[model samples]
Target: MKLAENMLFKYGSGKVIRVLYINPFTSIIYVIDMDSNRWSYPIPKDDFLTAYQNKEMIEENDDIYCRAVPEEELNELEKQKRDQAWEIVTFFKSKLSDDEHMFISKYRQKAMKETMAVFSISYNGLKNILIKYFKGSQTKCSLIPSYFRSGARGKERKAGNKKRGRPRKNGENAGVNIDENIKKVFKIGLNRYYYNTRKNSLKTTYELILKDFFVKEVIDENGVKIPVLNNVKDLPTYEQFLYWFRKSLNDGKREIIKREGTRVYQQNYRAIIGSSTQDAELGPGTLFQIDSTIFDCHLVSSFNRDIIVSRPILFLIMDVYSRLIVGFNITFESLNSYSGAMVALANSMTSKKELCKKYGIEIEDNEFPFCVPNRILSDRGELVNGYINGSIQNLGIIIQQTPAYHADYKGIIEQAFNQTNIKILPFVDGAVIGGNSKRERGEGLDYRLKSSMTIEDFTKVIIKSILFHNNHHVLSDYILEESMIENNVEKIPIRLWEHGLKYKKGQLRILPEEVIKTSLLPSQSGLITPKGLSFKKMLYASKYALENNWFQMARIKGNWKVKVCYNPTDLTDVLVFDEHGDGPFKFSLLEHLSMYSGKGESEIEQIKNFERELERTGKERELQEKMKLFTEIEDIVKEAREKTEAEKNYSKSNSRRLKGIKENQKNERLLHREKAKKEREMEVILDESIEEEDEFAMFRDWEESNDDE
Candidate 1:
């Protein structure tokens, strides 16, 4: 694709530049570099296309680019906001001169900028106050802000199409009645549009609006009335009802406001949808719920144990029908699909026996589950584009993406998260109240400052929460929660899970370990070179992978895209599946990743970014230069310990990540030692007659004896 506004590109100064504004006339793009420095540079179209072709630049995923401001600048902004917020309000009050402060609604939205130009207040600090104070909230005799405009559509419509009076009523339809019949239809349509949890279309709402207005009979909002309209002859046109339905009686923005207020209406508005009592034919492995939420608790560094850090992210997967959590992961790492898919795959394949043991959770044999769901119901996040979606598709699992904000689609899991958090947070130190402040009881009690729980302990708490939620907490699906115990049916989510396992219609498919590993890990189509599998700008091979000169034979496959799946958590190994000319597809691990053995996926990303910068300057850095760059990064981090470290957010995140890498490397070393010991010990008896000779004794003699050349 050609260069455009908001596209991310590599610059010659070794910076990743994000395009802020592009001027087509001058071919100049205003960009903010990674260091938060701005630049306006002109480039020819040919060069932009060339950069794309060479993969030196990339397009935006979300169509919006942003830059971090310098910390000093951010601090100054906050200071100004604190100091001048009320001053600007006073300035506006003086300008008002006792009369209500009148301005165009358009002007009101942009008032902060104008105020910033005059009195200089921080937008972040003043935003909430501005909304309340200006919108006529009388806080201690403060002047109210009021506005006049065409109608609700003033913002969505073009300035040219604007009319003087209310725009909702098509100029001729002003005499519409709010009679019982009309009001019934109006509400039916309105509920579907704004109130109902279902994602309804305007066409459907319009049809319902017209039909109820003409054909159907229903009670009005008032109990005493039937037909509020005195005459059927005087009733408005079908077209007019359609207009009013869209308009919501001159407040068409009502629907827009509610929708914008909460993007996931499914969870937030499930009661309106009436899904709290509706039960689908669901069981274990029917629908998997996957989502990521930052924990409400703070954490400390693993080594230091005193320094505070930000909340770690929890990626959860649950069985919707049984209300049982299937798999989950807790990491101080960045929230992304990498962690999301890992948890999804683990939920499908890995048992929680080891996890429960580590976390000190006691559960009955059937309390927890490891069943692959038939469908994955999730938002259209990066996880959908990740390996989980494709891998599940191969296993015939339908992936369902609900309309954004429709929480009812995954209500059970949503409620599960809330219940889990509520039960777990109070006992833990440094826990944020998550909008419910009852748990916290102190002044100057910064939860972020009070952090003492390590990531591991936080994980233990989370695991314990999930187990308690699944096994002990009584689920109230399709019934009143209070009545669940009185109903005398199966209560616990695990009981429901056990029942589902025995009676659930769908059969579970268990995949092989190799298949799970191959499918779950991030993969690329690689070419098998003579040395090894050439992948991700690096080569990897194992002794077994190179057995019988398979690498050389792999080239004969010719044009076939060899599938290679590598764990980002460990770049030292990549599992490869390749079909050469003669034999079946061979599955092998390419363990020798050269000097990249101990690198994490994030570090690999760093290297790719560094390479992109070097490529932009028409130069290539060798392995030594690349290693030097990493050293510089390390030195920068070391310097940051004393000079730049504030709270433990980034530091703990980085430390936890490095700790994971070291642990993985440590395991890798142990595995190598074990592998060598196994090689020295492995022996096969040649003949039955020779079986008399002890293989152990022969091996021992061979180990003790030195051979002459």
Candidate 2:
């Protein structure tokens, strides 16, 4: 190839040389040994080219072979030396005329001596300046000082009996050198104090090393252990300790993890190399993040406004590509469960128009489209259930669960929850202010006491907030592609979503709403009885069961159980999947259990518990009443026995006592009838006298008034 100034070539002996200058008229080339900084004799151009062609000399493109030091990187002394060297080189170059042939050794030797005499420098020093100037592409940076080479860089210095560095200015003895024993102490101190979650400061760690390694403890006269420090001159200085500590850490990440916790390091210190959108190949509906958070505000029950319902769980599903909140569900479920997660997923894959309408929210038709994402990323919590994961996978949707405590994997949804809370919690009353920390006696009012909004009202508020977020909230930090920027697309989520649909290859899949709902809704086992299908202690009726006479057959043969699925938020109906592949059918609550038609699964369970408690109380009362009746019978029997014993003389024989039983019974019956008739006559006479007195009382008072008149 072409030969240029400062080009490096490797010789057969593995020696590298840099081209310095060339004489075109004389056809001679000049080069210098890069490693030794020694000049080589001039050679004819044809011989150099022949050597290069024969591979005896190979060209090297690596700049490190003969790299020049930048002038600005030099220190003050180095800068002065560079300037002096440059001035001498400039004066030497002026001695040769522009048209003169300077490749000859005779001319170079004569000019070098005159330059050395004019600059008051040695011949070798002046010659070295010229060589450096020519070797570094004839630039001023080539003359920079090489004073850094005086110190042994990247090489360990041997320790002597005397102190290694500069003497102390405080008139005190300098510390000892860091030998192998001191290095062992440093390792022990770091492992015990520095590289732990205790978070000891560096100075503190150094002090601890002094106490544990340099000092000795002994019992004093009072039997207390007292610490005694070694001589100051024998101990290593803090600077030496710090230097060795830093040098030992070749892998900084591992040391950081050791000092801090894994969670803290991963959350705050680790490098975030890629985005979820890029991971999904920038395709909309390709990846979705799902998570649940407890709403900060307490809500009231819809049926009874005075009843305070606890904080509801809010599940959010977000599209990673556009940062759009695709679907959400709000319920009074205290914890995240498979039912709540599945309900949220179902909402994500279906249209939100009807749901918004139910909450009295009107929106544009295309505001939030039905998005069935190909993959869902979530934490290893409720979504890790085998049944739910298996069912989702069967429907061709992948469920990816992140490792425990790594919420950043699903950061999109986590951020969405924070944004929603920031938008709504400030305005809502009864919202938890700090968290569930106990109030100091009477320091503050309980948030539960201030609750006023019903669950329905709270739901409506959430719906409006989500609608505003999807349509208006600006994604200020959203990264846009070139095409989107060219089209002048706004950073609003809805605009980004529309743009993605137009230009990006979407991974959205559409299945029938029923299919998705059936696949995602949580399922349970139920039994078929003569009355109806029993599920969660509530009977449900279905058309298929009635038509096939399953209940009647259960009465004759035996009860058979069937696997059914139902929504936990609404226990009004259960879905029974047909074994014959006829699809699932709905089972409504029986007419007698209409009161529980709209109750949640938790509410139904509470009702069942209350009924059990009531039955227990009734049993207790019934036992007391029965015991009272038995005590009365015992008292009557005791009285009869005592009367017989008090008579002392006579009890009639059995035959004699029974001889006139029928005649005596007839006489007693006649006496009893006459006595009852007389009592009725006496009651009638008393009623008549009272009625007559009441009827004439007004007339009697009138006659008395007339007499007075």
Alpha-carbon lDDT, every model: 0.54, 0.73
Candidate 1: tens digits of C-alpha lDDT, residues 324-429:
7887766656765564456446554556675566457655535566754556666556254633554454343556765656767667767777887778777887
Quote the lDDT for 460 in model 2.
Answer: 84
lDDT top scorer:
2
Best by TM-score: 2
Candidate 1 stretches with Cα past 4 Å from truth are 1-279, 301-309, 332-339, 354-365, 382-390, 434-445, 476-489, 524-543, 546-563, 567-574, 578-709
| C-alpha RMSD in Å of predicted model 1 compared with the true structure | 33.1
Give one digit per residue, the lDDT tens place, for model 2 in 281-368. Answer: 4456778888898888888766557767678888888888778888887777756688889888988888878667756787754687
After superposition, which runs of candidate 2 have C-alpha atoms over 4 Å from their true positions? 1-274, 279-283, 299-309, 331-336, 351-368, 385-387, 401-406, 427-429, 452-457, 479-492, 505-507, 578-582, 614-676, 695-700
| Residue 412 of model 2, lDDT score | 68
Clash count list over all predictions: 12, 0
